[model samples]
Target: MTDPGMKCTRCRQPARFRLPAHNAHFCDPCLDLFFKRQVQKAIKDYAMLRPGQEVLVAVSGGKDSLALWLTLEELGYRTAGVHLCLEMGEFSEASLQSCRQMAARLGRPLHEASLGQLTDGLSMQEIVWATRRQFCSVCGTFKRHFLNRLCLELGFDTVATGHHLDDEAGRLLGNLIHNHLDYLQAMWPVLESGGDAATGFARKVKPLCRLEGAEIRAFAQVHELPVAQGKCAGSKGATLLYYQKAMDQLEADMPGTKHNFYLEFLRQKAAPPPPPQLGGRCQICGAPTMSELCGVCRMLAQARQWREKRRARLAAEEAAAPTP
Candidate 1:
């Protein structure tokens, strides 16, 4: 619940947004300060990054990512934006444009990667329908592969993403429900780089993990950030969204529910075992993997095989058809 009549807690000016958990409201400047402080605190608490380290922010053209890039840039970090273009359609283009706009505001360039380019013209949507796999499962595999490739190629040692408290809380719920201890072990604010070449990821950090998604969106709105208007078409009906909505309801009923929930999880989780050793380097991409092919390579191989089978089937059908 918000009190529109409230004033900024710091300067007593008109409050643009209300934070129920914190019992506070803020105008624009104060909100900006609040955003920076939260991110900085998370970084400091987790030792996520060091000064002068290059940070590549994985932006999805969403409000949360934009706010993070803005806050990091404002805090004087050597940050750059990386927008992985899935080239699925309008959503990808819009996302790219938003990232470009955000980077332009700070007079910096945004780096890019493309699914089509990596897959030789196959998109994730194509792979989804052809392979009968879920959108997120297929997409996440490719994204991580490419994100790691790009981060390493561009000489960035650290990669920051926009996973907020809502994201983590939802993940925690799902993992606990399924008793997925492997994923639970991997979850953290700062994930250290892989010990060997096969880890296939940079030092990944989520500075926004301590903040709520709604609060981050509010900050973006009040600051007039250019966020992509809608979510990806494939993201509809996801179970993660359900968990997030459940968390939201809990928060509405009881303030500070989300923050306390995540903090307590971090406090009490048992010692996580070491990750399983990779089988070997991928045959195709030489990436660390338990399988013969890395995830991205396997996806591309499956996509191409599916396309070939479809073409052969169509040709056979045409050959058997009566002369037209």
Candidate 2:
């Protein structure tokens, strides 16, 4: 049937891929079916997106997001793509090109925004340096802000992201280790639109939560999806990488480990006593916030201060350089 190899678990055709967690091998078609089924299961189980609710997919030009956009389109959902350009030099250019290529391939409209416009002419790296905040923290807040803004402007009520099983499993490990109950409560397959109308909050869902990162990469490869290659330069050595590596090692030792860890966590539905957090509009951007100032506002304020200092220092250095 397929390429003359081991029989596919479903159809006895030659298997092209093996899923140790499922204890099965599948041909190309079966693997495709499996991906769709898992996605469908997650969406239905969580009531993630309604039949006709417009979905604005957050595509980062990564394999996960590429797979998500393609899968949702294949599943017959009305969808569009939103990409945030962090202006990280070549990486940013490659990412935007990938998004455009995918959108062209799928014939879907792609919306683009830049870090400079989003953060008062500051890039993500600049924001991190200026605010002395973690890179991921700064990037996440800005991305959230942009996604919320796009969702409102485009009239998309549901915003879907590309978070998958491996990501969740690793995050679960960290949260469990740190005993961060508030973050635990917040990490759901579906996060409803928050804040009032002015907040530009849209319902966020993770349709790919059931698929593994490997599965997504493989799927993207098989389908020839145009996804940006290479990791962001900013995330060179993140703690989350260690957590993910630990989970990967555990999963290698025991199949289904990652899947079970994340799924069971969701199934248990344990809620800890909610942590005390501030709740008010960001005085600057007017987004919903746990604190008086939202993350973007805080970063913007610091970024401006840092920029001024940087300019002054550069001017001093240039002036002091004798005989250029």
Candidate 3:
């Protein structure tokens, strides 16, 4: 049922993969080259990286992040990895291992920061319990704060993320569905990082923004990258997953739909005007936030209070227990 005689679009070699979105077929060598070229083009078009600048890549051990890291390294950039250990049991351990292996293979230093250690001994589970928010919401806040903090403290010139075309399209679709115009406007291939420092915020860029999810996965498989195969346990039924499913179905129905939609958004959208009050740093954590306290600080405070109340309740229960 396969087309054995199909040829690659670039070369006359036998096709190894079919990319319906691009209406293209590529051999193994061509496919790998195409993947790298897309990332390089994105970086050049956006002016993401500079010569001799240190880039801190946020790696999660997944295909996208690993592929991004590998591609940047191959492109001869000064790249390092920062992985957050959320301690989600086996998945967390596997992710951390994969990240370490990736760093070792690339010969780059990998910094591991545990959530418990960073949050004053409060685990991700405790934060979720305390805040009563979605797991991803809490996790995302922590990652953003810590990633920016690390970039500032370590003197990284830029922070690169693993957001590809499919991720951007899904996020756009979700924002449209929720009428989040502000977020929609803020979405771009390159953004000024919201970190506070004397040298200004470290720019954030997405080198893989033009590639699709399937393409990245294929590249990772072809290159044999040590990518974690498991999904996050907390994101089992996340809203973003539903949005991604919808986007996938749409893309399957009409190839290039995702690319067109996201590109149009990037070209025509503008960030919403900020409120009259100027944004300032959080009193508690000293991060750049609009409010008096940053979201991470608020969550940590709630987590601490929750732990205290839980301890008191347990003590009261033990005291009230009858001798058996």
**Looking at candidate 2, what is the lDDT of residue 133?**
74
lDDT of each: 0.84, 0.84, 0.85
For model 1, residues 224-303, the per-residue Cα lDDT tens digits are 99999867988877778988998999999999999998878887764333434556888988787887887778778888
Model 2: residue 306 alpha-carbon error in angstroms: 0.9
- Between 1 and 3, whose lDDT is larger? 3
Candidate 1 RMSD to the real structure:
2.1
Off by over 4 Å in 2: 1-4, 270-278
User: Which residue pairs come into collision in candidate 1?
Assistant: none
Ranking by lDDT: 3, 2, 1
Q: Per-residue lDDT tens digits of candidate 3, residues 1-324?
A: 126778999998998788888999888899899999998888877678875567999999999999999989988888999998998988999999999999999999998888888899999889999999998888887887788777777778578999999888999999999999778667788876543453235667899989999999889878899988788888866778788899999999999999899877776754422222327878976776678988889989999999999999999999999989
Which residue runs of candidate 1 sit more than 4 Å off their true CA positions? 195-199, 270-279
Cα RMSD (Å) between model 3 and the true structure? 2.5
- TM-scores, all candidates, are 0.93, 0.93, 0.93
Model 2 alpha-carbon miss at residue 274, Å: 10
